[model samples]
Target: MISQNTINTVFETARVEEVIGDFVNLKRAGSNFKGLSPFSDERSPSFMVSPAKGIWKDFSTGKGGNSVKFLMEHSQFTYPEAIRYLARKYNIEIEETEQTDAEKAITDVRESMYLVSEFAKDYFHRTLINSEEGKAIGLSYFKERGFTNETIKKFDLGYSPETWDALTKEALGKGYKLEFLESTGLTIPREDRPFDRFKGRVMFPIQSMSGRVLGFGGRILTNDKKAAKYLNSPESDIYHKSKVLYGIYQAKQSIAKQNNCYLVEGYTDVIQFNQAGIENVVASSGTALTPDQIRLINRLTRNITVLFDGDAAGLRASIRGIDLILEEGMNVRVCGFPDGEDPDSFARKNSHDELVAYLEENSKDFIQFKASLLMKDAKNDPIKKADLIRDMVTSISKIPDRIQREVYTQECARIMDISEQVLVSTLAQLIQKDLTEANKKQKQEQKPFEVLRNQNPKNTGYSGGDPDDPRTGPPDGYMEEPGYPQQQQAEKVDILYRLERKVIEILLLYGDKTEEFEDVFLKSNDEGEVVMVSEKKQYKVHQRIYLSLQEDEVELSNNLFRDIFTDIIGFYHQNEKFSLEQYLMRLEPDFAQEVTDILMEDERLALHDWEGQNIFTKGKHETIAQYVSETVMSMRWFLVGKIIEELKSSIQPENSDNTELLSMVMDYSKLVNSFSKKLGRVMSRYH
Candidate 1:
């Protein structure tokens, strides 16, 4: 366990923007920063970070939390791991008690696999530099491939010995379990014995975005026709090939800085490009490009330049991936190397500046590249030329932005020497066909749910069981008031939920601020006439809310809100001062996240450049007292209405003596009316 002092120090010292900026491309949005959500695929920016509060929220996915929580959500780090990462980043020394073997055994499977993979990465690297076989075979192969020792060490390149069981035995003797090794695809298990999966191969350790080793790729140096030349770790808990891009861990920052990524085809391609001073390159590792991989790059950039080898067939197959990228609302360009040369070979042969110049000078928009590449194959054949034109139109249609689609369509028309009218008609037909198919698919998916709705008792107007029992009187769908649908009742519930959330928001924002408040009550005046009287009193915002709610016997209906309310009140009572960072660090992650969401919900308004439009907004602190009093009063009114609802539900129409329940309803109604008058608002929803 990390000491409380170290955790507190980290919380105070580590800036949220500084930590998250490493992964997200955040730009200034007024007082806050805004960026595209890393958790979802979004073209427009919806993720906001509040540096004042040390929190971030993604409106796209509704995930929000402090700096530590962001790491946990984005990188799948456990709480302790997140803390350690922050500790390392901030250079805070972690004070800890050593864990026992029993405690170590309780570590989860995914974490165990991570540990095993890291161990293998270290073991292989050690062998490559220190062992005779590794130096002669693996190290020599890497050196021949023009990899310097620093480059080898930087990427954690390594070697596995020729003996199948060498790594397995070494790991086992070091007290690492076979279960984790096999789970990570490092060891292949058998009844008689287990052996290393990458024996006799040079290793390339694949890392997560946060730089944890998740798996490895290995290359065979010798000519063994029966054995595959390149092998990757099979899909494991921590590594899914389609979702994992080679060099993403290294390239994410560069991709964000350059605002473009270089998509390549293999691990060596990524490494060579990086060596050639292009750090924004990632590879699909030869698998077909997947949306998840594209999304990973999309988080950092909106532009991708796919580098391809000269093979005509490979180029054609890769064009399909360009359509996927276009569908994601990203700009894409393509650059193909000279015949008989791949990215790795071309990058190796050129100086850094030369390689970069070749890419910049040769790269073309997807439409231009597609048209020029296919026009040769369609020479003078009218049928082939029409097919090629339609293919280009199909790729163009995948762009989500309408303006972009129109622009690309014009470009396609010019490239194909076709009439703009003909292309537009074909594009319209393709779009309509896609829309129709999508609607058809949606209806098919909802067919079973539609049957379920038809079969429902409420839909059939048959209210279930014991109809004579007043407890089960009319169905909830049958309303007492005329012209008010059941949906309004749902809307009322939403209103209450919003009010409850508002109370939480107020407490979180101003719990410690002292303010003047009006204490109102009904009292008998001099002539024995009842009149409203108010007294000026000063109280902390949280104390006022706590006392008011307690006096009315109102309890928060939502479990999360109630828990948070109790904790905040107790924290205020116990401490002389409140620290937002300390309070966040003290709560469990989920509770802290809920608090952050509530506190930062209105921060999105700042992103609209409202001040630039001369539409000024009031800061919360300026009206804390009014805000707190109104929220509490609204909550009281909502709760009173709920009480009226319960009383009405309890009245037995079948029985004659329902006087007490009806009188109780009238009393609550009077209270509601008084609250409505005091609030200077009518309960229109109730009517």
Candidate 2:
């Protein structure tokens, strides 16, 4: 188990903005930073980070939490792994208790798989460099393609031996389980025999963005006519080809730093680009791009440049991915090599500067590239031209940003030699169709129990309350006012709000401030008629408030306030400074959400855009902060007065002529006067 001290250090030292900023580009917005939501496909900035609160909120996804929760959600890291990640980032040493035998047994399965994969990677790389067959075949093939030793190691390029059962036997001899080896797809088993899965093939280790080996891709070396050129591991618990992108682990930092990514089609394509000094590149491993892959890139950057071979099939297949990227709200551009060349072959032929320059000049926006490619096929055929225009409009409609969609529409109109008005009308129709479909779906999927209220209600036919009953009458003594109950509810809400605000302010600002105030004393009721008896105590107002809440039976409607009140009572016992920053930094998402809801509910509209400007000179209501401050002071004074009244009522002079009773009354009066003076000072400051 992780020690409490370790957890405290991790929570206190890790900053939300610092941890998330590694993977996201955050620009300053007010006291917070704003960025596009990484959890969803969003164009506008809806992810906010508050440095003071040490938490983040994605308004788009409605997920908000402290730094640890962010890592756990974003990277799918386990709790322990998330803690270790932060510990590593902050240079903290972890000292954990040893696991028991049962824990060790459970760990064996995953650990065995990881160890075997690492062993196989090492075994393959050794064969490539040391064995004559691997050196003559696999090594020569890679060297001929201009891959240096560093590039080979960077991509974990390796060669598997041709001998069957060589790897399987070695792995089993190392105390590794045969079942785990088979599960990872490193070994194949039949009814009576088993062998290494990648025997006689060059290996490409498919990895997750965190560099964990998920699976492998292997290429056969021999030119046998019946042999398949390449084979990949079947989908397993750790590896899903559709969700994995090659070189993502290596390229993610560069992609985030450069604010652009280069998408390629093969393992060698990624290696070649990285070798050619273009680091922000990843490959699809020859599969169609999936939404999962798009979201992975979306977390890093919104701009993507797809590099394709200049062949006809490549262009045809590449255009299909453009629409998917558009649907994800990503900015996409296309760049192709010279005819008959791919990223691998082109990078080999040109210098880094020349290749980069070529890509820069040839890269075109999706609409322009699509138009240029299709214009040749639709030349002078009216039906084909119309179909092409509609296809382009369909792609444009997928863009979430209206401004970008309109710009693409204008570019398409110019490229196709069509009227701008025609394209605009087509786009408008498409948008309306999309909206109509969305509304239809929403209605069809509406919840069965949702309520709808009427615009107006008729009065009831009878009234039960007496006309002169004070309990039923308005305070002004007129006919009982309509919505009087609602008015009372509003007043109750205001009282709760003011009280909570004062408590939070004290917790945040004056938690360490210690000032002695008189505490009212109570005597036995029998002493009230004859003489007074009193007991005096010295206490802090903050402590008095804490004690009062503990003694009262009032239930707080706001859950967050109730929790904060409970925490305040605990803090009073501890006699420590109430750290609002630390509390907010470590608060759970549900609690943070509740706090935000309470703080923002029914705020003054005049303060919406105050920005520290005092434009309105409404006496003593110059700013929302000041108004709230005054309201809070009033509520505190009222609560103290109520406590004093309760104490006064407890005295009874009839039982005995006790001097203690008299002292108690004087102490109670003193407490009331001191509380009144303090409250007046607080109100005067705001006024």
Best by TM-score: 1
Compared with the true structure, what per-residue lDDT tens digits does model 2 show for residues 557-612? Answer: 45666687676556656756656545654556666655443332212122132335
Estimate TM-scores for all models.
0.89, 0.72
The reply for model 1, stretches above 4 Å from the true place, is: 100-102, 455-485, 522-531, 603-619, 640-677, 684-687
> In model 2, what is the error at residue 224, expressed in angstroms?
4.6
Give the Cα error of residue 608 in candidate 1, in Å.
7.8
Model 1 poorest 10 in a row by lDDT: 473-482
What lDDT score goes with residue 261 in model 2?
95
Report the error of model 1 at residue 99, Å: 3.8
lDDT of each candidate versus the true structure: 0.86, 0.73
Models, CA RMSD each: 6.1, 9.7
